[model samples]
Target: MPSAPSVRSPLLDRFGRVHTDLRLSLTDRCNLRCAYCMPAEGLDWLPRTELLTDDEVVRLVRIGTMRLGITEVRLTGGEPLLRRGLPGLVARLSALTPAPELSLTTNGIGLARCATALREAGLSRLNVSLDTLRPERFAEITRRDRLADVLEGLRAARAAGLAPVKVNAVPVRGVNDDEIPDLVAFAVEHGYRMRFIESMPLDAQGAWDRDRMVTAEEILDRIGERFALTPIGREGNAPAEEWWIEGTDSVVGVIASVTRPFCGTCDRVRITADGQLRNCLFATEESDLRGLLRGGADDAAIEAAWRASMAGKGPGHAIDSAGFRRPARPMSAIGG
Candidate 1:
């Protein structure tokens, strides 16, 4: 017999933020070695046994939507496409009562191979990481010559009918900073929304310097050189500050995570591939959901733990404060 629906309060923090978005990581394994995310040789991956089983992922997500008020779910990863049985997992996630909106973030290396299957399986949207359009620059940044594969994956994703296929690019000062205009142009031409993110302090190398990051102001200036920009005010807790390019219906967004923090309105929580619950992206502490799930705890216990974890979420990431510290895990391991 089917279980009755759970009636519980929404996931709210002491700061009065209601968490409605969940960023769930399926695996800590990735195919690319992006310069900003990982070292040339990637870090050690979690053992397969340590990862949350597909059944476990569904149960937790079910608790989130049915018990809590989570309405949106984005599957992240070192690269989510690397997860086996991805389409089947998406199908299960989509079948939940009050089914949350499903999205995926990927480097788009082999997305061409599975885009249609993923769309048919209930993926609602996609965000592809593409730093540069130049093949040589792409190879230099990623340490792999897979630019062609990524481009093809973008096209395949669009053809698969994924609307608003967002392209996420990080403009490193000495690397792809000069290509900002080109990147925006390409996105506008391709019917994809372009998002330029400031290089954050999440790399495995811990070499992030504020001076090397391309600021949001500078990004808008670069785009202004080629096209006039009209500010499109942000809606809700969205991290991106968007702008409309004159003469076209295309829009571009900038995530100034460092210079312009948006923590006051943050409404998202994360679950690592190994089942650690994080209230914030830069949170130092994690609540052990994996232990609870494996220890035979009931749904009520898991719900209590999840809510308790969010209660301790700090006011903000505090990247600019002197007391700020980077997370122990890098971006790749932390699911981007």
Candidate 2:
């Protein structure tokens, strides 16, 4: 028997979780070929006709924020920077009457050129994926030699007044695990927040092994050796468990999605670049919002579609359950 839904909103799930954060993937094309993310070559890009136009994105954001009470919206991508007219899209989203807070997650390769513009267009913050600080290791991990470009982009993001600039690193065991200390040092030196994430099963190659993951405890134990860590009580629905380094005011966070999943408190929903609504990152099924949009459906119809999809969200992603299977699409296709 399920509990009653929230009278205040329709976004509330059966478990009483109110979905507020929306991760919208702007594109499914990336410039780099990270080994864990996608293949080195021969990837088929989504047809331009299928992608949601900037106007379409703005329309959905309006419906989400105004009708559904979504409070925060994070723009993501294969690489969001790859999308044209993105700042304009940001401006439109920021103009909503009760505009939801807007942020972006990027590979940081193109920020150096557009960080100032993005900030001016009303992007509030940024999370850049930076797996390794070593130039050689960076090249090895991403299969790209643009580490210096990414570093410059991080600096540009900070200089452009993007508050709380954070770096997200997915440290694999025996891959970039040894560079955690150095990565921490780099983040501290640059006054950026650092978040270490346990590698998930979203890899393109489908070769992820649970035993190979560097668990949250392992990350904390390793970093604790260099700096005294004081755990900070995480706020509601935040996936990361943050800590403050003793003596240094800088903070670090670990998103232990694999070891200790936060699906119970997850307040997020994702919309793929192709306009599919996903209730969970590892959701086996998707609801097609594109059909509603393209079929001349009204706002009410779109909202109804959203509510219907979210109503079916399960207790968790079931990654730890027996006979668990990975989603058909990889992280790049699913939007990180």
Candidate 3:
């Protein structure tokens, strides 16, 4: 390997954004096969040896926190709950000096059983993916009949003190877009923050088409017809543009990642389950952090490799451009 840099720099990309958040995927294996995420048959699971051990994950997170100035961490997965002893991982992360504001993004399938345990272990927040409110539509979109379980999980999360729980909805043009008002109502009634995200090109089945994506503008327009929404500005590095309801304290957000990319202010990076570090979710290339971790390299060398990867990050993901191409890995493998 080339000589290490004289000093380890913070994870700053060429765009001048200092990254403080890291999305760490514990496993690429999920329980539900959402239509936009994977095929009905599911994916071939990775071998046990290929995944980073719990120790390795904690070590990398410590390096990111101590050496690179990352102050936030989100544990994601094909389904993070699928990983064994996840609470233990959360406890270790919570014990870090200046412990990161830790969170998790899940499908809410398994959360009902372990929500209390995870909260007790120091998990602070959660974002659950729920596309449709109707049971039939949920089954149709996700190819799973576990909407009841998901609802139970949401309640469990709230009861466990995971406050300000958020719901992430990806509205497809002809799919769940019609349920926007209903979804908003559900979120408002349940005291959950709902954000509509435009569908991106990360499906494992390669079925994403621009014509089928429900844009953020369309979502806001539809919601406006039903509710009085006043535009509200969001705080630092938040991917959503929020709006507060006129009379009520309820609020909604829209993540226009496709129509209006937030790459300029993106303070986030992702590490895949196998240890590949990606500066952007739609990146066509990934740096192999697993290799260095298992090759007897010290923390400094690993940090250098991470810095090298972020140094080349592009200005934007360019999803609306003609030259755009979807990544080989799907959203599940890349984490939420």
Candidate 4:
């Protein structure tokens, strides 16, 4: 017999935005501490007991799709591949009906080893974070020298047929800003979509000296000097503003979350490692869904909590407010 339709309320949020893309943080652990995400010293990670079990994550995802209209599921973390047996988790998440898009965001340190199994387990695409191509610069930025391993992972991802692999870069002025043309050229040559991200004040170590930020406008201008950028219309409330450089089947994107806020078109809801439903990246608040889930809250209740949080999502973050602070926790704790 076919399953009964859930008796939940309408899926559209108060913003009239339906929650379609869910960014699930599988683990708080990271192998590298990028300057933008965590403190230089270290941070106290959450106790194991606080994290949701794999089964708990799947249960929440089912409710999100069944009652809340979530259609895209992106697994993220400090580094999701750092989590053990993620292919199993991916396989389990892939089996959910309504069939949301399945993908992952990784630092690519371990992806070299796991890409094949993960692809077989049903991951559809990947966004790999690669800031600098120069091995020495990479070591300086991430405090680790594994650029070769990450390169192998990118190749493995392509070989495994991961479509539209995105390379995300956090452009810190004077640090790696000189490489825009080279980076764009590299992406075009490699058939990878490259995204230039403005450094936001997400953590203390990122230091986020406003002067050091290379805005999207500058990035585009520099690229425009080299290649003609034809803006492409985005689909279904997507995040990045895409522009294709003429004469190639390649496109470079700029995420203007910092310089040009796109909150009105925002359709993302983040689930932290501990299962708190966060509406905006800069929000000082978090709703504890894991408490209710582990405390015997049914799937419907979980769905309702997520709906309310998304419904309550602010039109945008208040980075300009007098009291606005970079969130107290590092990006690692918050799930970058």
Cα lDDT tens digits, model 2, 1-336, are: 212223336487778889999999999999999987777782688999999988789888888887888999999989999999888889989998679999999999989999999999999999999999888988888889999999999999999999899999988888998888778888888999999999889977787877778999999988987888998957788889999988886999999998889989999999999999999999989998888888888887788889988989888978888967788888887786
Q: What lDDT tens digits, residue by residue, belong to model 4 across residues 143-255? A: 88989988888888888889788999988988898888888988888888999988888764657787898999999998987898899956558778899889999989998
Model 4 spans > 4 angstroms off: 1-5, 8-10, 204-206
Off by over 4 Å in 3: 1-9
Give the Cα error of residue 125 in candidate 2, in Å: 0.2
How do all models score by TM-score? 0.98, 0.96, 0.97, 0.95
Error of 2 at 147 (Å): 0.3
Q: Which candidate number would show the highest lDDT if scored against the true structure? A: 1
Q: Which candidate is the best by TM-score?
A: 1
To one decimal, what is the Cα RMSD in angstroms of model 1 from the true structure? 1.2
RMSD of 2: 3.9
Cα lDDT computed for each candidate against the true fold: 0.92, 0.88, 0.91, 0.82
Per-candidate clash tally:
0, 0, 0, 0
Model 2 Cα shift for residue 48 (angstroms): 1.0
The RMSD of every model to the true structure, in order and in angstroms, is 1.2, 3.9, 2.3, 2.2
lDDT of 1 by residue, 228-302 (tens): 999997867888999999999999999999899999999999999999999999999999999999998888888
Candidate 1 whole-model C-alpha lDDT, 0 to 1: 0.92
**CA deviation > 4 Å runs, candidate 1:** 1-5
Ranking by lDDT: 1, 3, 2, 4
Spell out the clash pairs found in candidate 3. none
lDDT of 2 at 238: 87
